[model samples]
Target: MRRRAVVAAAAVLTGGVAVLLGVAVPQAQAAEVSYATRCIPPSGIGLPPVDGTTKVEITAPAAAKVGDTVDVVWTFTQAASRNPDIIDLPADSVQPSGTLKAAGAQSADIAMRGPRQNPPVPKGGAMVLSAMKGSLKLTTAGQVMLTPDAYVVNALSTDTSCAPTQQVQPAATITVTAGSGSSSGGTGEPSHTGTPSHTPTKTTSPSPPASTSTSPSPSGGSGGQTDFTGKVVNVPYTCQSPIGQKRATSPVQINARKNGGSYDLTVQFKKSVMDSPIDIPANSVKPAMQVVLGGADKGSVAVEGPKNAAPIKQGAPIEIPDLTGVYKPGATGEATLSPGVLTIDALGTRTTCTPDSSTVSLTLDTTEQAGGASGATGGSGSSSSTAGGASTSGGLAETGAGDHATLKALGLVAGTAVLLGAAVFTYLPGRRRTR
Candidate 1:
């Protein structure tokens, strides 16, 4: 009886430690970083003080429900002094945009544009640049996993004419409160099938602290058993640049996977760092970037058990293991995640990629059609319907691999403790009886 009691106590203690490490490490250590854009006015030493003030006001519904189509708009009123060629605010950085239709109040002098022809936006919309007031509208109609999130819309000025730019002080704040309705198109409480307490909040604000509360489930993947093969991710980029189409770099395939099942997927990925020059049109007043990330890496993410699937109900975050970031110089003279890693938005070219093993090969196929260059100078203006590549700061929260290893080490310690207790209990009592 005493031996049995001893074994039981140790087992409980070890199990407790195992569970605690698994829960606490990931929840506490995962980087809760948020990134955003800050515009800077030009500072000239010898030239005239070309002071420009660009004020932005966001008009959005205080709260929105999933499935309900709504319009979230941004109104930009540029001061008379500044002639900004491109004003960028990432739509996803602001809120959970569904069918967003962002537009800039049509302008005669400045046309909306980006560094790459196609900027990254989940919901399709064009960010435009006009001299006066321009607007951007996005929708969160069908997305279900939204929660109460505060958005910080950073104002960015990327003009060849703005010569030198600096960070805008006191960034604007916007709140998007997630409410539950219809499982279909109505709003309701956030589903909590053990979903993360802190949702993705990078670029604008630090993610909320995760609940220390634990809710463990049995060893079984969630329902909706689906097997996806060759889940190739396609990260959105210009695919072709505006100024130099032929000079455009190729798309780097950072990661790829083939789902064995929901939780049992096999993945191959790489993480490399590189520095390249930012693109600038010849006629545009802006100069090329000083340095940008340019390189490739090897190795991918590691997956733990109990996986979930798409349209994942019950509120758990869709964690794509092995999260990483691609650092680059921002439009406003700052370093930010050009293509943030491990985010639902950065989930990559989720549109069923080209089937193949591990290898990235593609040319800079210039999608640069005939269009007017944006600057303070003269040119014929043309409009396109794609998201321009002028990136405003944005980011995604991620739990690093080191955190995962710590949890595993704790589990191993617990398992060893349990075994040691059982062995000692059996041998010591038996030896006493024999003596």
Candidate 2:
């Protein structure tokens, strides 16, 4: 079988801020440029992986709505720490570049906007969210799918894009998988870990909504619960990507072992990643990982499936790759599952593989309508009750919740003062929050 090489066209990034932010719609005020790269499985022909034994990881929500503030993090590994002190490799030396295209090509587009921060060049370890804080905004609700034509471009000099001994992984894609559901949270500066914490500091963007968003009721689980103590399992996952252009799925292998109270998560990809490796730049770095966990059982039980979806649920630890160790494996996914029940347990194991900010949620799609479950799929069933977490306010992802509610209270105070001087007028402060 003749392998086809996936190539990249290095074009001067255009459109200025408007294009960069994807603010092509009338609703958008501003936008920012987002990053992307193409990483095909080793079976498929593509660019070789980076030489530094590095991996580039990008994280964002599985689904977003119009006016939603989506937080995007792109992590890279830096060489500043390994060989310290004197200036060696310069900054912005390595770029995993690409263009973002939404599925169905709606009239509106997803804008990459606001307060973009440069990730710190770590002296050692992996560089995280503090590294790249790119916010995503949807202009059209109809735009559900996203595909980025990702490719790498190294600025350093070399006879070719690769060196004789550098490790190389093929450019993979960053896509929205599983159900297209949105999440709610506050924004924060990304660090070398790329993980978003519970309560992040405030950003210039608008605050999160007062009420949390909810999602579909937690449904039945496909069976396969495992106690992955010193074991490895090859898990098959299905996601929608490469839309008409390319369709591929990496063979996933999960390596888990009990570590004291929690299970350690390690993963490997068969015939995946850049075939070999590429040269590592002077001071730049690649991603190690950003782990994602979800489902109703947050213990040693890991729910493995698509985003906003679940066909299989079992006991296993989750993992996100990082630059802290040799990231030889291919790559994992970000937005491929649904909002069942999720929590991070990466208290130990790897340091840089922090809990990722990627989130999926279940909403109050229905209530007990004085009737029992219809006992039918997609029916008016009473059993499929959604435990509400749906966000009422149209807040941005990663932004702390409740601030919008606080702002609403303040607005109410002002209204109350005016009402006292006149009639007893009723007001709903947070009504206008969700766009």
Candidate 3:
């Protein structure tokens, strides 16, 4: 009898331990896959389409039940080809978001967003994209296959959209079953990320009333225009010139006319001395300005002026013509306009000038249209053509081996581009000219 009781006690203890371990640990599933990815950068930065490989690792629960919320995570084990223009990418500068295609029992797209995290990368190194995290609710019980899809990487205010060059295979498979009990924080709705469901409904009713009240104002008559001129401000700029990095202050005058549906803007820059290392040919220098809109509106307008009429000597003062662009107000309020990046294309070589201080040059009160349509869409404006050679405009410039054959002939590579991007900021005496 004593021996039998001891054996029973040992069996009970072993069963209890097994039950405790089952409750504490959950089964996890993971898969690793490689994708041939191609990225098209934002226009005007003069970079062609870039091709590279992206290795992704996906992690999720191996098995889930109906109404259970499952957590999913994706890590970019390897990023795309390195961009030479991005010499220094600060930590937490990159934000990654992507979509996952779910098939089998549920047909939906699971969107994932990751927190910002990255170690300090040295110059000439590829950027480390952040990992993405998302979740999904199992509304039905069946096996679901999760496949990786296209993604976007927004780094340093530049957005690079990447897609797979070929058909993508499923990365991981999830087995789902009917829930034995209530699901852990699960709603009976389909799983979707990003925007809420009620957002579209809210916009339908409120826009008409908002447009009617704001369109008619005393300052701006119906179908009439208002003009604001002679607004002058000094803007300091740091430029990467052919000679070297140079700093100068130029007087910028802004004129604004609020048309019924849009605003016409004129930006004039004063004469400044630019000592070039090489002679710039006649009609070689094409300059463009990014008119940044703030306050009631947020976006940029690209304005281009005519090229130089005469050749610029090695050491000579450069006279830039007036730049003009159209601004369509997307919102109703006082909009402030400031001078942003100034890109000068001289002799097939591109020089970028970034303003140290963006002082507000003009402000105009705007209203929405009567039809409930916003005046203009928000974002960077259309790119203007370069004069001497093909160059990129606005944001970070992208250079690839396939598109830059001429640059390669001139002995310009990723390293040379890195030096050009690392422009030091300094202040110079303000030069003024009247229009």
Candidate 4:
């Protein structure tokens, strides 16, 4: 009897130590809930509202202490709905972002971002969205209920805001308690913080070997044509968008080859500078670059590339294809080339990016051909002129306080949907609330 008693005492002490060390904690079971949702299209677009069912499975920790940050994951299964228009949505284009309403111990809404859909969405086909993940820090100690809230789907640059039409059941619930004197071993930061937390990395592309050749000049004389290869330049750019100003470094590869009277220029972006916030339709994005010229030339030249052949999904890298243009030497000698401004046009919206500094990428030694062209012209069928000449044909979209206000309103709607879902689930028997 004494030996049994001693064993029991040892077991109790071991369990206590495990609790203090945050070991042997019970895992929270996932809970599934379904709710009716109504999505309203942007006003003045003359599109009717959409109604469907949304099923969500949420997983979270069963208990947490104050100041402890816990992970929350939500997987959504959207009801089948036909597309309203004939458009091609590229793979990973549909992105879902919304809020999770928290009640009881915490009243703040938690924002969530889901992964992009994998399959392409064809015209009049069913839409598929992916799973969402978020995190929250326990503040007040109590039972907190998390419910699905309003969400938004950005497809082909259009915002379709959605909410639950009926009462929503809570997807999960988390029990919060006072923090222990020791650390909880939790990450201090939340996963989703409204803005992206990615850092841009510098990248370079390999260059080709330099070569020299001769071509017949416009004046019937032999002109020396040289090819400058393997030039990589990194330019810092600031881009203005609906969200805010985003800064990144774009690595550019430049190659110049003298062809008779003019120099053939090719510029390629080694790395993408920004991510697309919404799905971009095929052939919707047109990219252009302004190349600064020196030495033999004094002004900048405009180069244009073809429209994107495939659809660009939301959150994916926005890539600009190779830009080609022709530059005619004005005075001869050695000419210098550098990257300047970059412009992107999506649908009707224009995004202009200005480089902080122009780094010289290529230089070519040449003799001016008689009766050669004077300014720069696009090689790929794009109309362009010098810096002091006619501007590119495109109007900038209006953006300001209105865009910010719209985003806030959408967030509130998402929060409300979450709260309603939680309240409905509380009344159902055998259904536990989740956060």
Model 1 per-residue lDDT tens digits across residues 1-435: 999999999999988999988733211111111222222222211123232333433334433443333333333332213211111223222111111122221101111221222233222223323211122222223222111111111112112122113333222222223345333323222222211123321121112222122121111112432322222232322111111111111122222121221122223222211110111111111001101111221112222212122222212222223322211111111111112111111111110111111222111111111231112111111111111223221111112332111111111111111111111111111122121
lDDT scores of the candidates, listed in order: 0.21, 0.24, 0.57, 0.57
Q: Highest TM-score: which candidate?
A: 3
Clashes of each: 38, 78, 5, 17
> Model 1: how far is 100 from its true place, Å?
26
- lDDT: which is higher, 2 or 3? 3
Global CA lDDT computed for model 2 = 0.24
Q: Which stretches of candidate 1 lie over 4 Å from their true place?
A: 1-53, 56-74, 78-151, 154-315, 319-435
Tell how far residue 365 is off in model 4, in angstroms.
Answer: 46
What RMSD value applies to candidate 2?
30.0
TM-score of each: 0.17, 0.19, 0.44, 0.42
Preferred candidate (lDDT higher): 2 or 4: 4
User: In the order shown, what is each candidate's alpha-carbon RMSD?
Assistant: 33.8, 30.0, 21.0, 16.0
> In candidate 3, how many Å is residue 379 off?
44
Superposition error at 255 for model 2 (Å):
70
Top-down TM-score ranking? 3, 4, 2, 1
Give per-residue lDDT, candidate 1, residue 10: 100
